[model samples]
Target: MLIGYARVSTLEQREDLQVDALKAAGCDRWYVDHASGAKASRPELDRMFEVLRPGDVVVVWKLDRLGRSVQHLVDVMVRLQGMGVGFRSLTEQMDTTTPGGVLVFNVFAAMAQFERDLIRERTNAGLKAARARGRVGGRRRKLGSSDEAMIRQLYDSGSVTVQEIAGRFGVSRGTIYRTIARTSKG
Candidate 1:
């Protein structure tokens, strides 16, 4: 049996075209997910998976209808293959039941991976250059040096509790404790 899957990113969008394609491809029944491609989980997709059998073939209007990313698509393909289930993407004209289809899918996956690697490499290089110029990442400290000194004084005077100091500085009690601990260390 060929089980079809369709997807649209929002409630406002329709899966009419996908449904038509699935039907034309001779799908026995179909599932539709009204969710973003970025989401890792979708109710209809999960439900469809529950009913898949060894000899079943999963059909989709397009590969993107089935997964959020290339990695996700590959993972789904692997799972389907393990279950002896075939995959057919009408738009891509690829079928995991055939050798050429599998080769093309693997090539696409490789390109996606290479693109991700290049993005990561460029980001790392940019960060390295910024660090060389004495620029740093992450949030700035909530408490300045003067504020730390004041917190330490207030903590040592025993006039205020750590909670009271935290309230005064608009920070957490942990920050107050750390400020006092820094005084001991210095």
Candidate 2:
């Protein structure tokens, strides 16, 4: 049995073309997921994989429909292979049932892994450069030690309302409340 998988990023998008293509390609069953490819949890795809069996061919109209990243696609392919399921991508002309197709998939998988490594290396280098330039990353603390101590003192003495402290400290009421709660916890 050939199981077809179709995907669209948004609910507004149509799945007609993918469904027609998959049916035309001789798919016996079909699954459709209307969600972002970047998301790891795809409910429809999970269900399809769980129900797939030996001699089952998982078909997609295009390679992108299978995954957002090449690494992700290869991981899914490996999982399918381990389950004795075959894979077919119409646009990429890939069929995991054949030796040639297996070779092609392996090569693509290796390249994808290499690309990920390069991205990680580049990101690390960029961060190092930024640090050398004295650029601190992430958010700054809302309240300094002196302000925090005063806030705690005021709260402990019950001298001021949370809204009054927030207005005086130039912060939100929630921030004032949280600070009081945190100081109380300590």
Q: What TM-score should be assigned to candidate 2?
A: 0.74
Candidate 1, which ten residues in sequence have the lowest lDDT sum? 177-186
Across 15-50, the per-residue lDDT of candidate 1 in tens digits comes to 999999999999999999999999888999999999
Number of clashing residue pairs, candidate 2:
0
Residue-level lDDT of model 2, residues 1-186, one tens digit each, is: 999999999999999999999999999889999999998779999999889999899999999998888899999999998999999999889999999999998998899889999999999999899999998887886998789889989877788888888989999999887777766754
* Candidate 1 global CA lDDT score: 0.90
Per-residue error (Å), model 2, residue 51: 0.5
